[model samples]
Target: MRQAEKRAIERVASKRRNKNSSSSNDEFEAEHICIRTCGRELKCGKHRCQQMCHRGPCPSCLEAIFEEISCNCGRTVLQPPQPCGTRAPECRFDCTRPRPCGHPQVAHNCHPDDLACPKCPFLVEKGCICGKKTLKNQPCWFEEPRCGLVCGKKLKCGTHSCNKLCHRPGACEDEGISGSHCQQLCGKTRSCGHLDTERCHAPYPCKEDKPCQAKTFVTCECQHRKQEVKCSATKIEPSPQRPLLKCDDECLRLQRNARLASALNIDPQTHTNDHVPYSDTTLKLYRENPQWAHIYEREFRVFAEDRAEKRLRFKPMKAHQRAFIHSLAEDFGLDSESSDPEPHRHVCLFKTPRFVSSPMKTLAQCAKICASQDSSTQQATIANDATAIPYNALLLTNPQFGLTVEELDAALRKEYAAHPTVKFHTSFLPSDEVVLKGSGTWTSQTLEASLTALKSTLQHTVRRLKLAENVFLCSVDDSLNVLRREGGQAQREGGWSAVVGRSTGRIRMPRDR
Candidate 1:
């Protein structure tokens, strides 16, 4: 060992001198035979290695003749004699020679083909550690044969009663479904359904390979309940429609007047007021609904200071009272003159325009993810079903895509963000005044200038608005040659030149064919 170390130091010093020496004026030194490459002694002959003959001794090792490693099977391979690692049972390539060392015992018999030694951490009793079942895209964590992280924890099956052992959904905090986690115990092996950390794992794209090693794959975030790329998926343009919202039955019974229900948007058969009408607006709305006429004049019209009396009085809307907010809106409007309205009283933030995405994006989702890449590993499981992250910063925080408070905050921060855009819903209508069309003949430079002017006025009122570009979805009527400001494309000239795109003159008009 001492001699080898000394020789290595001498060789390194010699190489450094040669690299630094570039004296053209000096006489050319004859090539030294001893220093020249001495290649691996394969069966071909005691010849120097092809690589060493061209280059110097490999940087990987100090020896001129390197030992070749291979798997237990017939195939031959090359591996570093010793892996440089601090961890016990460090990973290494398999040494597959029949008779490698000068020892009497053959290498295969001593190490055995079925088991993996500490030098090469990929062995199992029956098959390859890689071939073991594991979660898709997770790292392999096999310690030795079957001894692993899973062995320590006594399994608790969630599905059955605590007395009876069975893995059930929501059975225990760490309990996973048998089918969901590939029926493998935790820590024994990784599970499937999640994305590999090395890949765009939004939509899991791979399956479990029993032959593949555990922990070699990465853990996915969307296991059990698949997670969406919170900021990436953007459907900027689509047809407009409302989802069906349902409410429970009990709340439907107490609040049962159609006129009052119509204003508060509650079913006359349902609804019990949750909050007392502190302001006078509630009092007027309580009477205005024709059905509440007797109650308005007789009971609710008179003011009572007793807090408990007021608390138990009005009706509470159902739990899923999204649609019922109209009754509250009407109530507030009814008493607008009597009391000062809240700042947002008139702004229609909910239920109007059919929101379409902005054609524009603040940043490309892929660009950001790729830019922040630390690992270049290709995660096969998530390679196919990646969700397109629109990559909008604003959209991440704001409720642009019909989001409420709960879903947005919990999403991964670095993975995606919301786009800045003006959303136009179905309730939203474009301006009535149509701009006149201009001449078809225009340069890219001219078109850009015209488009810029149109954009300024069309921008959203709030800079932080999480809406995507709704304008891109705005298409001109067909057969009418609307002036479209599309760059490079010839101003649409065919058909009845009535519809004008922004490039023409920011208006729609007709021109002769």
Candidate 2:
């Protein structure tokens, strides 16, 4: 080990001297004990070993070789230089693989064959939600397009329309019966002939546990008993020909005795005096930690109801606690996400617009703030905030198609108008390729979604326009770091960098034909 270290140091010194000597008029001298690269070709045959100079035959080529690999669709290849055994590069081109849906194409990045394709993005004409008229330009993923008209189809009540967004009559079949219906009260008469105010649905008016709560007076068919009870208890049938309501246990016992007496030739009124009625009660079991669960429920309610508190972050908790909180957040209609590595990981909930706010401080900034604090506390804080102020910078470039950053920004905004949170800026790189820098506000979607959308949009646009462009996401920080290390390579190499994108006069292309 000592000899190897000495040889490495000597090799570096020798290289430095050789580089300087070559620039001057002096002859370069070789070091007697300098280490060098083991440039032997590996078993793969495509890559050479990159280990330090050593004795005997070279080991397997452990070096990661970046080479061109075909995408999943096999229509294109990306050459970003990855390891030999690494996965194939994602194709930002139209997937040539035939889709079973019969749509012209799928709107998603090219992925492995095992992965399912995303929903189709094409617009097609389909019947409105109400099945009354045809609607045009609806997304293919939509079961039925809303016609912007009232759904006048008669509901199960046979009186009022579902009055939901105008959707196809069969939309409920696809999205479940209750999923597509409106929340209007079901005004149909109940089995007891009383009006039911429950929500409108396709199922029968009342079920076992959801019996009608209205009070009504009922008497036995024998006219021997009378009582006031819930309308549902009366069990009134829609047709009047059904058996009369038996109001109480005594009445029920008497009826059973009468039926038995008729079979045995004994008077029912005389036989019923010996029987006793039975009753039942239900008991609910609580979870193991009732107090803790109550606290969680109460905190969730406070976090959900407070309008100003758009997000809630729970302290690091056990897996079950995190799961419980996730379920609790869902019940309140808030988005919940877990961050940081396990053991210190916790859940966070977000409200409307589903925006993830920017971090208050980065890792370095936090470290500086904790300079006077204990090492363990600082380390824990840093670990728990591993995702804070994460990779927010991205660069887009498509040199082959001569696409400019301005064009990329316009295409993205045009294609995905719904995501208004991200803003794109263009700049000229030292390599003469126009690069786009995209940054988002706290309200923006996740970075993964942004990257996917960017790639999918560019690929689709280029294909439609018949342009030969290949685009990929690069980090702005990476470029900046490279520039910093090279001492502003742009200026040193007589290259120029400039901000080119502006707010005025954005070029708009004609809509897809």
Model 2: residues >4 Å from true position, as ranges? Answer: 1-69, 73-84, 90-94, 99-123, 155-160, 167-513
Question: Model 1 RMSD to the real structure?
Answer: 33.7
Q: After superposition, how far is residue 310 of candidate 2 from its true place, in Å?
A: 63
User: Which prediction has the highest TM-score against the true structure?
Assistant: 2
> lDDT for every model?
0.30, 0.54
Instruction: Give the clashing pairs for model 2.
Output: 66-81, 66-82, 129-166, 129-167, 129-168, 130-167
lDDT of prediction 1: 0.30
**Residue 444, candidate 1: alpha-carbon lDDT:** 38
Task: State which candidate has the highest lDDT.
Answer: 2
Model 1 over residues 1-513: C-alpha lDDT tens digits? 668856875887788567657656455663543444456653333343544244434333323434444434435355555332211232244444433222232233323345653333232233223233333322223332221222222234332112222222244333554434223222211142122222112134333333222111111221111111211111231222323333334224423332354576643223232223223343334333534333432322232222232111223233223122333333322111111122112211121111111112111222333334423335432432222111111111112434333332333221212211222112211221122122235543453344344443333422324432322211222232223322222233534332223235554233211
Compute each candidate's TM-score over C-alphas.
Answer: 0.14, 0.20
